[model samples]
Target: MNVNGGRPQLSGTFGAVSSTHWLPSAAAMAVLEKGGNAFDAAAAAGFVLQVVEPHFNGLGGEVPIVSYRASTDRVQVVCGQGPTPASATADSIRRLGLNQIPGSGLLPAVVPGAFGAWMRLLAEHGTLPLADVLDHAIGYAENGFPLLTGAADAIEVMAPLFETEWLESGRVYLPDGRPPAAGSRFRNPALAQTYKRLLREATAAGGGHQAQLAAAEDAFYRGFVAEAIDSFVSTTEVLDSTGRRNKGFLTGQDMADWRATVEESAQVRYGNCTVHKPGPWSQSPVFLQQLALLDGFDLRRMGLDSAEYIHTVAECAKLAFADREAWYGDPDHGDVPLGTLLSAAYTEERRRLVEAKAASVLRPGSPDGRAPHIPEQVPDVLPPSRDHWMNQIRNGLPTVVRAAEARTDTCTIVVADRFGNMVAAVPSGGWLKSSPVVPGTGLSLGTRAQTMTLEQGHLNSFGPGRRPRTTLSPSLVLRDGKPVLAFGTPGGDRQDQWTLGFFLAVTEFGLDLQSATETLAFHTDHFAASFTPHEAHPRKLVVERDCDPGVVEELRTRGHEVELVPEQSLGKVCAVGVDRERDLLLAAASPRGRQSYAAAR
Candidate 1:
């Protein structure tokens, strides 16, 4: 009867299925089906993610989870992303001119505590035994899970970065003298050994939930892994002296002080649906604010493919992203005016400046202080035209065949049991081959440097001890004081953007979860910011095929840099649903992944 038994573990109302790279979604749902709560399912999935989606998540990554209590209707946000070592400093990497930090794994990497976050969640909400919850992962690592297309592609492209640098990496990734192919079974005995030791240590400590998590955190920070990582990092030129990034002095003390915080949600109410996202760690809220301002306009009147609609949204996106570039950063270190940015008064003022049926020139500048009066519309600054957008497909698109799809993996698991408990979790920003594991302990440290800006003082600028701005946003949608939808995506920075669009399609457009999620779309900045667009997709509206040609030409006339890409190009979302009225739970992974699926009861 154990979900962790030899058969494929699964749970949920509709049975779990998905396109996620991690196999843990099935394990978690199975835990719930076998009488485990959402927490148990999440823990089971968390453990499996470490085994199957190893390059992205492990004992060393960070986690941010969203939980909804069915009884009290309380929604809680748990910060899962870990912080930089206390000793880290911005000055340490000054010579690299900040750019080193953005593309950096060696100089700007921080202490990852994804497992620390998971440990806390499981201890607080799980009913299954810790060892039992970890069984699916252990089995996979001991036996082997095939390298699906997504993960394999990543290895082929990025493995050279690791194989040439670390021996252990070369061994784990190139066991047969090449990266594992799709359907080629892969096992990680080293990671299994690490998890085994950690579980044993946690179970032995014996304590309440908080204490249990604390004990597990201790296992990695001050125990065996710490000693090993400290030695490995110091001898290598991975970090600098301050332990800010791959500072040469990675110490147990640094890892011990690493903490994850759960912050309040940034909320947007459009009609009956209230969109929610974690505070400034991501750019989702800023986008939401822009959407609220645009609510007063008639998007349908502008039409779907009209140049007016696309240009309006594009300009708004540019403005929002500019603010993100300027003011978004770790809240602990900087003052982000999130409250003021989303204020209705400011939104109303912004709405007033829009030109009806036309486009305006976009200037990159910070929003001014709140003004008492709405601004007059300035005309002819930028000319707009009626450009029709070609919808490649309104529903689903044929994903472009990609040779680069292999380097990524992520899993999202949502749970709602009879008790009304709900959880949404997405792990790892996908360090992949960038971050090498610590010898013996398999400590795959967080490689968050990739998401941050290297420019000095930019909100997302990389600093020694600051958490990098990430797009890994796990969210919960509460309707009528009840949690209705819980979801997240796995496309690095694409997570927040895609999530914001889904929230809008559902709340503003009145679509159901499936309809909302299935809506083919373009990212806010299109391909300007998130360059990983889907030009190869057959059904999605990408820059190349669907822009009505006239729309692109018109936009180009206005000084906008437009390119074609597919909506599902980079961000593949995995979601779980709860139809509380029907007493049904729907769990499904994206079909994009060859091996991904959901099994629930």
Candidate 2:
């Protein structure tokens, strides 16, 4: 390891894998050693992450994938985000006497999409069988893996609720009527059995690889998994963040009706590289927008970690994210104006908004002469005391609190193989603390619907069969028409900010992959967040504690409400890149959480 506690960068010609956890990184490398391609390895790693990092992701969550296929010389997005139930309308939610969706429980459940997305990626691009890719995850879930400290604390916080309300969750998380201790061996036999049954159903079809994959998808959506979720939601009324017990709106038909789709990526050209991100349905294009705005600036001269660089980036991020709140939504449901938002004229106009000092307001630009509309900001009604389980749930995985908050963010996976395939995926939601686990499946539904607004006429208003604008964004960068880097981080609403800083550090500052991943980062919460009870803190900037005191004082002098946090508390960025000039592959993982790791041959 380096003196700064970060691992040494790994370089090779064979393959590389980086993720937020060590088990999945190693498992992905194991798949690559077995001659599977990047897609196969990523699928394997994704499943392992679900089992090992249950606090960050599960089978019932969502994942938005951006991949570059060497064969086709194409980059495409696999949209794994599920839509709201057909009956979950704004009026219906209002009838429940709630102003905003709860941050936890069944009422916010969306159709589980992560399993289908993984199956789709494997079926299309992978050279390995489904059974081969799934065996490692099954082994971990059946046998056991050492429980993480973060996971242990989450279970302990929710222990009271488990013993009283969500009994099924208690049965799985509290195996002996108590929360398991950190570093102790823990197993989820129910989840293991769930995957076992999926495989059994797949193989029973007795066909080729594609047929078996199709069978597995059917088992999860139109079959037993769907049935289990429907039965539980239909019959159960569990307590939620609203201080009321309510049944969910999801149905078996919703699962049967939805399937992950493959769409073209929204991209922007920055110098020699072309960066690709998921479409407007995600908060992805905000990254591209920031790149567009920064293309006019001379960041290299600003100097890395200088007050000027940090202020410029944070200011640009505020404007870009302001547009995200005002205009981004599911394009299939309404107009997103993405083409105009990324146009040169709009970018140039928006770039002029960044000043020498931080601006203390949300300012979304007009694209194509359209007026911008923003939802009403809701103030956070935090519990009177931290003893409430709802308080813990709000601070749990998939949610990023403000300064000095818990470290329960999300998870990321980036993989590359010698075959030239590259993949970046952010798999999150369906956290253990987000909802109660289904009895037999040992998995819970995601609260992604809470990210959507209930206000009518908003771009991201709640509606039937609409994908909520999610914070999960992955990035793939290509140089000279070939994939060179796959990178992303796990920060709710701040994903783009952290990843953009990493990309610039590597591209402009000439830092190696490891150095870029380990660099100190800063972000601003200047716009309304995408999580429940959307709140904003105008002009607030958070920097790592290790930042130069001179720079901190300079930022404070320039109108930024600067707050300092531990050096490693900001970003959990992971990256894998190809050095075509050297004919080598490189990988790096953040040392922030001490859990992220990178593996290479």
Q: Candidate 2: which stretches are off by over 4 Å?
A: 1-5, 379-387, 394-403, 406-408
Candidate 1 is scored at a TM of 0.81
> What is the C-alpha local distance difference test score of each model?
0.58, 0.89
| TM-score for each of the candidates | 0.81, 0.97
Question: RMSD (Cα, Å) of candidate 2?
Answer: 1.8
User: Residue 146, candidate 1: how far off, in angstroms?
Assistant: 1.0
The residue-by-residue lDDT of candidate 2 on 225-275, one tens digit each, is 999999999999988776668899999999999998999999999999999
lDDT of 2 at 478: 96
Query: Could you tell me the TM-score of candidate 2?
Result: 0.97
Compare the candidates by lDDT and give the number of the best one.
Answer: 2
- The sequence of per-residue lDDT tens digits that candidate 1 reaches over residues 377-441 is 11111123231101110101111124333222455666656666778887764244445667786
